[model samples]
Target: MDTGVEGRKASRVGVRVSAVSKTIKGNRVLDGVSASFPLARVSGIRGHNGSGKTMLLRAIAGLISIDEGSIEVFGEKLDARGDFPVGIGFMVEPLELWDEFTGLEMLTLLSSLRGRPRENHLRSALTRMGLDPDDLRRIKSFSLGMKQRLNLAQGLMDAPRLLLLDEPTNALDEDGQEAIRQVLIEERDRGTTIIVVSHDREELDRIADVQFIMGDGRIREV
Candidate 1:
């Protein structure tokens, strides 16, 4: 299958947020947060609750508009209305899955929407996430770990160029967490840029090429 588009000329092929800030309901969330998540490496963001970590991820994912500063994915500048930066995938706090669709069916549908070739790519992603591609159970029937794996499979199946995962190991045991870590490392080796947000400092330290700590809406390299 053809991998998506390639060769976007930029100083880096990943996410760049500059002096970005946001406010929600008159409350400041991101206070001049600036960071560069480089291509082909895993960059981790560690922060406590309400520290603007998830908000930063949302801004980068084009899920919300920033009240100040700019965000660029690859080499392209982003605005409120533009299509989500191409070749990007994200798994955030609450996933909205079609409870009626079987795991493979969901993958097939998403691939169709994304214009990605199905077959090998979708199955490979499921396998990588330790999910059985042939599992015919509907998403509502899946256990917590199974649901998490399915969420991951959806994000990774198309081989996105920039992957943003928020608390990727939220519902998994040790083995499941290790599987995700390995997959992330593999993705990095294959030139897929990654930005992960987790409270697990040790996990970030173990896998991240660079690490940042977010606090009270501020971000700094650690």
Candidate 2:
């Protein structure tokens, strides 16, 4: 809900995927895909199940190795063997969180890992996602929607330069989904390069500066 951050342009450095290919269990997931995502804008990808959308995101996050080709973020190559790419925040398909930890605590842990302060940004991110920052309930007690919100909170807490979210609006009511859209719009305006995968075409049309349609292990702009 803060529109003040709007209009800040990204520093013109973004991501490039060149001839990326991946295979799992003898099935081709990404077949020589290549694309460039501009900074400070949102790129939306829409696809059916098993269309390799999530796989592509994981590869960009360096969570999985590509069978061939390369991914570059801000002009730097992403290596799975190296530390997580700096200024990158991602929420792929399988989000792992500590069940016993409170929402705030979970974000605190991530902030610690990134060597950043937690108190302010943690609360801000939670509230922006329509969750109560003061709630002390364990993450295990959260509903599906709340858990999804928490997943988003953690990704946004670090103020990442490059954000990758898959099915970001899953398990949420319209209000909650709208809140996320607004947050993403603000982030995009402030020069945070973002890539989102969603089944909702309306959401994609509203937010994505460029759109990609994925099918049969290949991605193409529409």
Candidate 3:
């Protein structure tokens, strides 16, 4: 990974949550789960199946309809309607993508959705992720690894402040996984707050500054 980017801050920021909780179908999925993320550091959410790791991240990203408690990014509380998930970026478990759209087309549409994502930045980000522009021409027809690469490119397009990734290493080869690690490190260095839910302990150990273990919807620091 290249930690060679200039014009970046040396110190990382902080993310805090207060009295946070979430439930579904009368079942409390996340129980009073609250934690903080330090700036320019990688945090890991590790847990077994159905442990609410994804749910917690979803709530933080405003993808899930949060009903209880609150989330804060950079000391600001997020209301459902406004300033929520401040400077956040995320990719969930199910891997949402427009199958019929070419990789370039998909990214272009995403750029349009967020006002405007520099055309040059999009190509550069994809290159940094080890993807060729040619890959976009047939991305939907590519394998899972290709799709994952596209996803990574998409999430990093806007260079969001807080990034949430669920099982990002899955469907990737060793080289691809290493590439992602490098990118994550570089992004953290660029002051992007990151939270990843992964099953690989060794891999998480390499990236996480803070780690959490989840159980029965409750989370505790490891």
Candidate 4:
């Protein structure tokens, strides 16, 4: 597999939010946030509910309109800047997939949109995530943890250089959470930058290369 030339100036995009602030109606969500999520490191976003954790992730993902600020990904500036979804993957608001499809099926279908995916990639994702391949049962039949693993599998099928996950431990047991954490650490080790929004301070301590604690829609260095 061609890993591409390292350090080559190929329009590489890194997540950069500078002095970003967002307000909805009359409530402020993100207040003049400025941060840089570099390439190939895991950063944790922790905050109270409605503190703008998810909103911040969404803004970075280009899912919402930014009121004010600059968001750059893969090195491309976003918000009237240009396209920056080159190598970004995210899972939030529940892994949306065909509940009728198998885990592998979901991975292939979702990844194929990005490009060709290898059989080993999908299979390896399943194996590494501790999901039994034989559990080819419909996604609707899988438990929350199983579904979450499937979500991770699909997101990783693209081999994204930058991936963002929100509240990743939402529906997993201790073992399942550990497995997800292991995969995240491995991703970081393999030069994949990751940004995860989690409330589990301990979990963040385990995988985060840095931490940002959100308060009143603003991140305070902790």
In the range 1-222, model 1's lDDT, one tens digit per residue, is: 112243223326477889998988999999998888878778899999999999999898888888899988887889854346778878887887899998888889988987876789889989999888888888999999999998998889888899999999999999999999899878887999899999989888777877899999999987
- Cα lDDT, model 1, residue 1: 10
Query: How far is 107's C-alpha from truth in model 4 (Å)?
Result: 1.5
Which wins on lDDT, candidate 2 or candidate 4?
2
Q: What are the per-model numbers of colliding residue pairs?
A: 0, 0, 2, 5
TM-score of every candidate = 0.91, 0.90, 0.89, 0.86
Computed on alpha carbons, the lDDT of every model, listed in order, comes to 0.86, 0.85, 0.77, 0.78
User: Which RMSD does model 3 reach against the true structure?
Assistant: 3.8
The TM-score between candidate 1 and the true structure equals 0.91
Query: Candidate 1: which pairs clash?
Result: none
TM-score of 2: 0.90
